[model samples]
Target: MINTYPLLRPLLFSMDPEAAHDFSFAQLDRLERCGLLSRFIDKPLIKPVHVCGIAFRNPVGLAAGLDKDGKHIDALATLGFGFLEIGTVTPKAQSGNPKPRMFRLPEANALINRMGFNNDGVDACVERVRRSRFYQEGGVIGLNIGKNASTTLEDANQDYVMCMKAVYPVASYITANISSPNTKNLRDLQGETLLRQLLSALHQARIALSDQYGVRKPLFLKIAPDLQANDFKFIADLLLEFEIDAVIATNTTISRVDVATLPHGNEAGGLSGSPVLNSSNQAIHHLFQSLQNRVPIIGVGGIQSGNDVRQKIDAGASLVQLYTGLIYKGPQLIRDCVRVFN
Candidate 1:
């Protein structure tokens, strides 16, 4: 299937990342409608495992920023993910940064996008989720929440809280995004002091909601790849202290040290692709090693095959995920990893 997908790559790769994303989703939607998505796809290994107190059919998941608005949840589930995370949705809608915000470094198998949390907001995402039948059929889905693009870092708490409240009813889990480099001052929330404050607020919200609604759901943190050892240590400590349920070990890297020779080396935004593999793994290892498996880590960077999935699990990721890998390797990548897991 990977080989077959490569046939389409020439055409898909010819377009911008954002355009290609739409094209792929549209194709997936068509496949699902025709009941032929699974024909090209292999049967997923349905071995279920418990993580974050939720059951997943497999450990491989679709990372956020791919299906940012929960638009094609059913189509995504058909691709064989144990779970699909959507959004970075905020309290209100915004147009994001600008056109040409997404760049492709095909030679490096990477993408650099300054798409500042663009989405139709939390309500719209929820409507899409509510309308999605995939969740009714045992698909695990995560909601990645964020502050509105117009909001300030100091006031990000309100935005996150609102999204949490709005999406909690439908999401299997929640990921608080504090690490998108494109949003101005957003990463600042990752600071020791700010992180503590934000996590505390979100935790309180989680507890209050759980008690009030009598429903218990996982709340994880989506951190940045740009942190130092000190930052990692502090974050791990904070997670333990705050009882943060899980951690998405990275978002993307703002640094471009590895792709220096590439023509688009100095491009802005976070770099996610083969170049991020080492840094992300190191961060995952640092967290996994320091945390000592106290919390589960979802490692998602530069993964394109079964071996990459194995490496992430070996390093300490309880579950693995991808975005760039799916683009470069195609849909067969999911079945390949599930084959390994089985």
Candidate 2:
């Protein structure tokens, strides 16, 4: 099939970035309902890999933040991702930062969004996931949970615990998102002392939830890319100490060095897409070395092509995910990455 996104990009680009996002998904949902989505894209290649005790059909996954509420799991699944991670969801619903929270840097193939953990909340997301064909058919679904914007840093652990317990039964894996730059001081959770406390609480909660559900779900941590050089080893030690299953190496970066001169380059939010590729890859390499293969790394950031996928794997990522790349390259990017793994 001829890739049609290039032709369609102009229309979407003309609209507001956030509006374009909603419109794109709305259209995708329509096409999926009509069962015509596959007519425009090739099926993703099957190249199975077992990571963190889950058998993935391929290494390419739709990263968190794309479908924040898990509302389009079935539609996205049809496009053929090995996994789908939805949320950054919190204990309560939020409107996110505000209008114009998301911005596009077309020149840099990047985006800057301070869309604070905006979602339909955990309950709504859980219900949506429950109704999805993907979940019912045993597809890999990771629930990435975060604290409510209103939740205080001191009370953050409770929010995370609540979300974990609620999603534990449904989540193929659960990620504690402590790295979003958009959230005020959320990254403080990454501090050594605070991180230890949070991980310990989560470890205990996971133990109980594991016994309660009669199955143990892997717990993953997502960290920011803008960390000091020595942080990786310390974080790796904690993961080993707490028996955490995996780490999503690097979230959106707070650094704007790469896009400072571009339009919307100075936006006050986490920078993602091509600008983040190098930093995130460096984070993965650091984590990989510190982890020594004991813990798996899920590489995500600025993955726009099959070669980018190879770079992540070479850097020691057992798996990789796509978000911004999808916006620029469209669904064809999924198949492209999958073929690289094959």
Candidate 3:
């Protein structure tokens, strides 16, 4: 599989980034459906570990935004992730930003995406998860929830609450995605007062959903990598105050300093891949220091190699996730990370 990716790379690179993304997933799904995925994809063989009370086969897992609707879980599951997270699924379906929203910087091994939470809505996503053989086979699935673009900041809680309830019954964990830079004012939810309000609402909703379903689902907050010292401290404190299960320290960064001179570096969206590693590690280091082991951190952003994955763990990430790295390095990256734990 690793050897083949080098050959497949040119064809994928020639296509529009988003189109390539969709086509690749479709082909993976077809291969999986035909039972040929296992012939090429290596299954991860790391010792299982627990994070946020859920068991994971390995620490390497897929990040959200790649499979926005939970439609490709079964196929993606074949790629050897310890756990699979899908969506940034909004309460309702949305078309998301505009065309040419996802760009590739081959030289830097990076991507700039402002593809705002485009999906087939929470209900549709929930249905897809419910029907997934991988999900039913006990694959750990985390549902990442976000508010629709049309939903105002003031009403964000309702959107999260609605999506939470719908996904709670099926998800191993739920992520509040208030950190994506693409959504208008979405990052503002990270402000002290609003974050407390939003988390309080989500906490109450989680309790209700737990009672109704007889299963307690863990809740994680996905935050931006561009936070300052004060902002990071405040968020760590809020996570403790609200009893949030964990924090995915560092979503894509709004900073373009590292890639400013590269093509599409100045694009108005979150920058991900190699350039984001430093900022993400800094945020993880801050959160790990501030929370002082009270809250666990899932490190994401710019992880492209096993050394990069190890650096994140050494920086205090309990578990790590990858998106852009997978695109650049291919499925063997998962094997490489799993080997780190071994």
Clash totals in order? 0, 0, 0
Deviation in Å, model 2, residue 164 alpha carbon: 0.3
Cα lDDT tens digits for candidate 1, 171-260: 999999999998999999999999999999998999998997799889999998889987888999999988888999788899888877
Off by over 4 Å in 3: none
The candidate 2 region of ten consecutive residues with least summed lDDT is 37-46
- Per-prediction TM-score to the true structure, in the order listed: 0.97, 0.98, 0.98
lDDT of each: 0.88, 0.92, 0.91
Clashing residue pairs, backbone N/CA/C < 3 A, model 1: none
State the lDDT at 87 in candidate 2.
96
lDDT per residue as tens, model 3, 200-256: 999999888889988889999999988887788889889998899999978998888
Model 3 worst lDDT run, 10 consecutive residues:
38-47
The residue-level lDDT of candidate 2 at 59 comes to 87
| Alpha-carbon shift of residue 262 in model 3 (angstroms) | 1.3
Per-residue lDDT value at 224 in model 3: 93
**What ranges in model 2 sit over 4 Å off?**
none
After superposing candidate 1, which stretches have Cα over 4 Å from the reference?
1-3
In candidate 3, position 203 carries an lDDT of: 91
Global local distance difference test of model 2: 0.92
Candidate scoring better on lDDT of 1 and 2: 2
Per-residue CA lDDT of model 2 for 227-262, tens digit only, reads: 987999999999999999999977999998889999
Worst ten-residue run, lDDT, model 1?
Answer: 333-342
